[model samples]
Each structure stands twice: as structure tokens, then as C-alpha cells.
Target chain A: MKRYFQNKSLLNLVFTFLGGVLLLFIIAPLAGMYLNTSFNSVHNAVGSEEVQASVWLSLWTSMAGTILFSFFAIPLAYLLARKNFPFKSLVNGIVDIPIIIPHSAAGIAVLGIITRDSFLGRAGELFGIKFVGNPAGIILAMAFVSIPFLINAARDGFAAVPERLEKIALTLDASPTRVFFTISLPLAWRSILSGFILMWARGMSEFGAVIIIAYNPKTAPVLIFERFTSYGLKYSVPVAVVFVTVCLIIFVTLRLIKKKN
Target chain B: MLVVDNISLKAGNFELKNINFRVDKGDYFVILGISGVGKSLLLESIAGLTKISSGEIILRGRKISDEKIQRRNISIVYQDADLFPHLTVFENIAYPLHSRKEKNIKEKVLTAAEQTGIADKLERIPETLSGGEYQRVALARSLASGNDIFLLDEPLSSLDSKSKNELRVLLRKLNRNGITIIHVTHDYEEAVSLANKIGIMEKGEIVHVASPEEIFKHPKSEFVAQFIGIKNFLRGELKALRESDLKEFSIDGIKIFSLTDAGDGEAFLLIQPDEISISNSVESGSARNHFKGKITDIARAKIGIEVTVDIGCELISLISIDAMNSLELKIGKEVWINFKASSCKIYN
Candidate 1:
């Protein structure tokens, strides 16, 4: 250790130390939340009605958002991976805009475009799908902010498929539609699943966006924030810890499935 | 019959221009070239994998140039096999036939797999198959499809020598069974052994088309000569000695004869490296042209040693290992090289 510190290449060592310090600093809050929990508080929170509602809403919305992501994002990802067209770069760049924007700004932008007065919002009114204070708005808000991860991951998976294999299928008289379903889609299914997991988790954890878009629906993140504001960290901590722990379990299970495949 | 009529295709930086050739039914036509000479591109264009920029692909006198690859009835095997990784070897061979809803799919797949000797490994995934095994699977897949036109893009390139030889025999057998094979390869020996008709491609153009024997004996141009492994060449003036009405010429300031009647100025002296014989002392024989030269180098060729003999400041003759041992030829040893006048061909 003394020799390592004395060496001139210790500059790299210094940077690595600083990075580890930063990682620990970032991880401290989550660690504290998990470590600070008492058995009584957890038991009480598990029995509470508001905590139950928040946990239920989180499960419902994340599942709905993931289903939406699979249907809407898979085709777009396939197109991005397999085809070259006009404005391809522009389209890909625009899809990733939500990933870089502030969550609050994304929520506001989504609200602006999706509120009752807007064209899409008015169109949705025909189908009785209201944005403000609704489960639909919660799902929409979560999906809007979390979709880029799914799209990009699935796109990479699809891109990794060799084009010749698809052509070989074509030569074998498999139609283009058949080829996509049989050859291209199966090869990229693992990436798409991982993307689905990411999108679901991100959507579940969304706080600022869900709060701005539809706070009344009270997904887990908003419930935690509301419980923190009205009843303090003592009241909200158990639910937050539970939600995170459940999400971790789901993430791990998805990862295991991915590995097996 | 497969007729590639005036087909031109551009793939990024390389372009196959005005490509015209015919592979008769049951012909093992090999496209021979160096890497990146657009041989693979040409085969792909013919297969409808790549769109032809111009011209018609006539198969059985039907213009199928604009047809989609699926409808073209062509099967292709790549160097890497490009087998569907998720599918088992059995499933992969069964894939094309199953997709077509062909009757007797299982029997076809098994027969093809048996022919390639990969029937036992049928249930294994592509990743589990070795290079040669994967290629055999690919070949089995193509054979199972029963497409008369087989586009092989150096399918045997990755195999070890023994497998390559075995596959060559298999390909020949397949060809004899009425598969019109357009084999693209960078290997000259593969081309020589396999091709009934060889098309030497250079810079995207089919420079020469001839039988294996004709190509080996008398290549048409410097490009064809070099591409076909003719390693001995000399730049010389074809001194047009106008004798009566008979116009004859000799190259390299050496008095030579020609069966190919010619009147020439500047020319390239071409000879098969194996045609020249080396001996310790010159003897009177059937060979007319003789030159005394010192051995410059000896390198191992497949069946024989390639001995390079330096004659004066000009000619270098490459002789065989058998000839070397018989004459006790070594580097710096003085030897007389002889070739029949018919062996020396002048290309201007």
C-alpha cells in the first residue's frame, strides 16, 4: 500500500479512490433507508391502508406501463435496428430526448401535450381517457419518461442479429412478416425483456413526473413523498424500503431469466 | 441453365461491372479471385440477396433479376454458415423445407445431414458445432432446400485441409446431382480441383473464363495468369522478326518458337512454374528452348518444391521438387533449364 501511494501512477489510484468515495456517498441514503428500518414500523406500515394503496397502485401502473412499452416500443425498436430511412438519426435522437430532460420538465411537457384542451387530449376524450387525476395519466407519464431505455436496449438487441440470417429465411420463402416474427424477434427477445424490466422499474420509481402529471393517483413514489411531507420520514420509510426491496426482487428475477435464456 | 447477362452491381466502394456468365445445369462454376475482388458480391447479386444495379438474371430462360430472393429458388451457404444460432442443427436444416411446407421435410433434412456426415450432431445448436461441422450443417441446409442453384461463398474456407478435401468431393457430388453451383473462393487450388469452368475475377470484372485445364495451361492475361497461381513472368520486347509472310517473334532476347501464330512488339513472357525442367547438365531432348541458370531460391509448394532458377539477368524458372532431387538442385547450384517451345506463351 505504501509503495502504491509513492508511485507516480498513483494519479490513477487517486482517481479510483475518489470514484469509490463518490459511489459510497451516492449509495449511503439507500443503505441508510434499508438499515434504519425497525420490525414494528415495517409491521405497522404493512398493515396501513394508504401504504397498501400506494403499493397496489405501483404494481398496477408498472405492469400496465410495461405491457404498453412491449407493444408500442418493440415495433419501433425493430424498425430502428433493421431499416435505414430518411431522418433516421433525427428520429432516433428525438426518441431519446426524454432520457436527458429533467423529470419535472418531462411531466410538464407531457401534461402540456396531453391535457384536455390539446388535440391528443381532446382525441382521448372521445375514448374517455382523461389525463388529469387519472390512472391513465399516471401510466402515460411513467411510460413517457421511461420508454427510451426500452427502445434503445431492444434496438441494440435487434441490431446484433445478423442480416444474412434474415435473408436466408427470405430465400427459403418465408415472408417478411414471418421472418420478423420467427428469426429477428426471437434473437432480440432477451434485450427486449431486459428493456421491459428497466422501463417497468423506472416507471415505478418516477416521483417528479408522476407528481406533476397525476399526483392524486398516488403511485408508490408520490405516496412516499406525500407520506414524508405530511407524516415525516418515520411514517414513509417502511413503505419506501418495501417498494425498493420488491423492485430489487423483480429486477433480479428478470436478470436470472435473461441469463437462462 | 443460369445466365447472368450484363449484370452490374455496386456494393459501397466496390462494383461488379457488366458481369456476364453462364453456369449450365450440373456445372460447378467457380469464381476465383483475391479477397475483396467482389466475387462474393457477384454471387450475392445473382442470388437476389443484393439488388442488381442493372441487367437481367435469366434462369431457365426466365428473367428473374427483379424477383425477391425468396421467390428466386436459390440457396446460399456462407463461410461462417450463418446458421440460426437459436435453432438446433436439425431444425436449421429443416427450416427452409418447413417454411416452404415441403412434404417429406424430415426425410430431406436427414438425408442431407447424412450426406454431409453431420446427422449424429443434428440436435446440437450451431454454437456447439465446430467450424467444419457448422459448414456441413450449412451445406446440409442448402442441400435440403433442394434448390438447383447453390451459391457457395467460400463455404469450405474455414475448414481444415482434410475437411476441405472432403467437402470438395461432396460439392462435386452435389453438382453432379444437378445443382448448378456458383462457388466463390480465394483459393486457387480449390478452384482448380472443383471448377469445371473457372471465371477469374479482378477488380469486380470477370477477366477470363475457361476450363481448369485451359486456364492452367494458357491463361489469357497477366491478371488471369497471376490470379490462377502462375508465378513466373518476365517483361520483354516481342522482337517482331518478320520472316517472309510468316510473322514470328521471340521474347527476352531468346530465340523462341510459338504454335500461337503472332506478330508482336512489347509483350509479357508467361510460363507455368511447373513447365520448366531443371537438370545438372543440358541433354538433347524434346524440349527446344534451353537456358543455363544458377538456382536462386527453393520454397515448398504443395506436392513439390518450387525452385527458382535465375537465367542471365532476365528469366527465372520455377521447377518441381522431384526435378530438384533428380538433378540434385540446390541454391547457388548451376543447372540448365529447358521448356518446349509450346510451353512458352507470349502475351502482349
Candidate 2:
């Protein structure tokens, strides 16, 4: 018992010492940025209409991407998790490609599909929808890079649901649609919600892809980049601090809601 | 009545070959087999949850092979209950009613819940319920559907003895209410107790289908005999008695008479342990076969003490604990084993 306690204490001490370094490494920079910036500067940055519009546009585009992509991603996640087909492993591997590849490459790939002269681009023209330099383009880029998170998480969620429940539901006279809606979807809702929040956060913080796709719409990250490049670090720090604080508040609130459920 | 007529299905690599059975209306039919014998797969195919590769399922004289599960009007309850975790007990029971858009959902749900003895658990979630209660909710849910046939896949396994007994009673009551049941399990005791007729499956094929007593007394094949755990599977030869129609069986020079109609030739003899009686001395028991053998072993069985006697061949007899003490049965004690001619089964 003495040896066991000694070993456990030593292991815990080493883990705590190592973990604190990484924790401090993350916190110190953010804390430094916040401490160096005066309250007046942050308040002024919040007051600016351009900053307000940029933050609002960022939230709007990310939320749009998260919701719209989820419709396609969720069912596909279910398929990925449940069905066995030819090249199933190949298809599963492809879902994570966006997460593995660089964001700029994903942006360019997405552009290839939506740009003028492409088949989808001309098809969109028939519907009077523009993709380039538009909020639509921003959503496309954001969703493209961040969709893997939703797909992976939702797949795990759907996989965790017992197939026997669905089978039993079907025998109880529930149609396939009713089973999907009432049984599979509700059981997988939590992981889907967590994935939703992660996708939104990742999409909003995206810069490289959004820059290549829709630089003019000026999402909060794009505005921060512009401020830094144009007026140096002094002008960008306050906006960065304020934007991060907003993201944290919203993310924490969403997490708490999920926990309650 | 439901008839699974020559259904052949290949689920992955495991194939059920030309499965055929008839479940009469209001009959409690049980398919007994070890795990992975495609019992659940067969049940799934009958419910239309699994599409048979080639075959027809006829129900009430109408072919339902091409019908979807929702239109089949069959309900199944699994071993672990599989209750919807997000839904309250009431909603879980009401699910089927909601699905088919029935107008009298609340009344049906309440009645079904009350019938399954889970009326007070209507407001609780599935996660909070005990294993027995969870199963009761699943039963209540299926009952609310008002289906003519219900499939139970090992509903009594993984339950405490008390819970198992309660579920068995509930299952008997369900069958009594005019619902045709096709239950699947590996437990022969459960099969014999609850099933009016039992089908024995091995390697995805129904080897035999008969009443529990018939299946136990006269197994059709060596596999069936062994699978049912028949202790005495002795090979013997039968010859006609000179004066009577009864046959005399000879096993290694030991003669035992039986009333089986199987022809006078090589045959297998099955003497159920419980059919054989034990006594300290010879008595006018009127048994056709009596052997004075030394007690080889005594083991505790679920029903009673299993006293193994070695005459020429070893034969086991199940006797009550009271009988065991009265007779002073112990290893190496001399005992007389007596079984009537009708009790011995002969299979060619």
C-alpha cells in the first residue's frame, strides 16, 4: 500500500507539472494580450460599426454553414456509421480528408466547384445565385473545412445508438422515417449538438479559407488580419481580445445547455 | 396463423437454409437453439425487418413477403428491452400508437402499461428503471401496438430468477390473450415451461418441431439428443418380443424393454433422468426395467439430486431431496434403478 501510494503520488505530480506548462502556455499569451489592451480601446473597438458588422456577419455565415451543412452531413454520418458497402472504408477515409488537408487547399478545392466556368458554377447561374465575393462563398469555404468535425462526431453518435432499438421500433409499426426521426435522431442529438457548436466555432475562426473565398465580406477574423497588416499589432490586439471573449461566452453557454439535456 | 414457408436468407456469411415452420393462431411457439444459430435472424425475417433472399411469408392466408415492417403488424421485444432512452416510459409505450396515427393512443397506452404491470412507471425515463422494469416497458410498448403476433428474442435471459419468472408469467398471459407468439431462446427449461410447441434449431436449420414432452422424450437426431442434454444416449439393438408387440432392447448384453414402435433393429435409447426412480431395495414397482447397480456419483441438479448408478452402463436418476435422505444415497451405495417400459424412448 505504501509503494502503491508513492507511485500514484509520483505519477500525479509528474502529470500535473507537465500539464500545467501547457495550460500556462495557452493562457499566458491571451492574458498578456488582454492586460496590455486598455478598456477604452476594447470599448471603442466594440463601438465601431465596421467591427460590429464584421462580427455579426461572421456569426451569421458560420451559423448558416453549420445548419445547412448538418442536413446533408447528419444522414451521411448515419450511413457511414451503419451501412457496409463496397469501398466503405474508402468513403470513411475521404470524410476526414478536409480535416487533414490545409485549410487553403480546402478553400481552393471548394472554389473549383463554385467558380465561374465550373459545372456547378454555371448551374448556380441558372438559379441566379452568385458564389464569388459573396456571403454564400464564405459559408461554402467555412462549411467545407469544418464539416468533417460534424460528420465524425455525428457518426460516432449514431453509431452509439443500438440498432436493436430501431429494429424493434420498425416492428412496432413505425415507418422508416418515423424511426429515423423519433429513435435514431433523438438518441444522437447530443453528439450532433456538440458537433454543431464545434463546427460553428471552427468556421467562425477560419481565416485562410474565408480569405481566399470571400475577403470583401470581412468576417471578424478577416477584419483582425486586415487591422494587423494595415496598422501593425497595436491596432489588431484589442479586436482579437474582444472577438475571443465573445466566442468563449457563446461556446460556454452552448456547452452548458448540452449538459442540462 | 403465420407460416414461414421455405424462407432462405443469407445474412453476411451466416445463411438460414430453407427454414419452414407454421405458427398457429394464438399458439406459443418457441425456437430453441444456442447463440449464433440464426434464431434472431429468423425472427427478423418473419417481422420483415430483414428481407429474405428468396421465400414467402404468409400471414392469415395473405402473402406478406414483399411487405415492409410497418405493414407487417408484428412486434418484437429484445432481451435488453431496447427502450427509447430519450422518451419517458409513457411515450415509449405510446410510440407504436403514435406511429400508426391511432386516435385512441392514451387509452391504449394506459391499458397496455397496466397490463404489463408498469402503470406507475409511465412518467419515468428508461435509464432510471431496473432491468426487469425496462423489459416490462418494452413488453408494454409491444402490447400497445395491438399486433396479432409478437416475437420475443431471449426476453427472459440476463434477468434475475425472480424477474425471469415474472416475465415468463407475463409471456404466458400475453399468449393467453389470443396473440400468436414466436419466441427464441437457448434455454431448454424456459422452452419446455412456456412453449406449447418447441422447434429445435442447429446451424440455422429446424431439426425438430414438437411439443416439449415429445421433443424431450424422443429426439430425432443425435445432435438434438445431445443438445437437450440427455444424459443417457445409449446405442442398443431392438428385437421383437416373442409373445407381445412390445420390443426388447439389448445394450451390451443388458436387456431393457420399451414400448416404442420403431422397427426391430439398431436404435438409440433415451431414458429421461426424472423418469427413472431409485430405491434402497427391490420393491413391487411394476417397472419393466430394473437394474441393481452401485452408486457411482451423486451430483446436485436444479430439480433434485442426480444419483448416477453403474449397473453394466451408468444411468442417472433424478430424485427428490427427501427421497435422497430417506434412501441414504451416497457414492458407492448399492441402489435399484426402475423405469417403466413406456418411459424408455427408441429412435432409429
Prediction-by-prediction clash tally: 0, 0
Q: Candidate 1's residue-wise lDDT over B136-249, tens digit each?
A: 898888887778888999988898988877777788788877788999999876776677899989899998888776775579887776566666554455544456322244
Q: Please write out the lDDT profile of model 2 over residues A1-261, one tens digit for every residue.
A: 999999999999999999999999999999999999999999999999989988988899999999999999999999998899899989889998988988888888888999999998898889987888889899999999899999999999999998888888888888888899999999898999989999999999999888898888799999999999999999998889889999999999998889887
DockQ of each: 0.55, 0.59
Which 10 successive residues of model 2 chain B have the least lDDT summed? B227-236
Question: Interface Cα RMSD per model, in Å?
Answer: 0.9, 1.1
Whole-model lDDT per candidate = 0.82, 0.89
TM-score of each: 0.81, 0.79
For model 1, the stretches where C-alpha displacement exceeds 4 angstroms are: A1-12, A117-130, B231-277, B280-348
Tell me the docking grade of candidate 2: medium
User: For residues A76-142, could you state the per-residue lDDT of candidate 1 as single tens digits?
Assistant: 9999998999999998999899899999999998899888899989999999888888888888889
Residue B60 alpha-carbon offset, candidate 1, angstroms: 1.4
Q: Residue A188 in candidate 2 has what lDDT?
A: 93
Q: Which predicted model would earn the best DockQ? A: 2
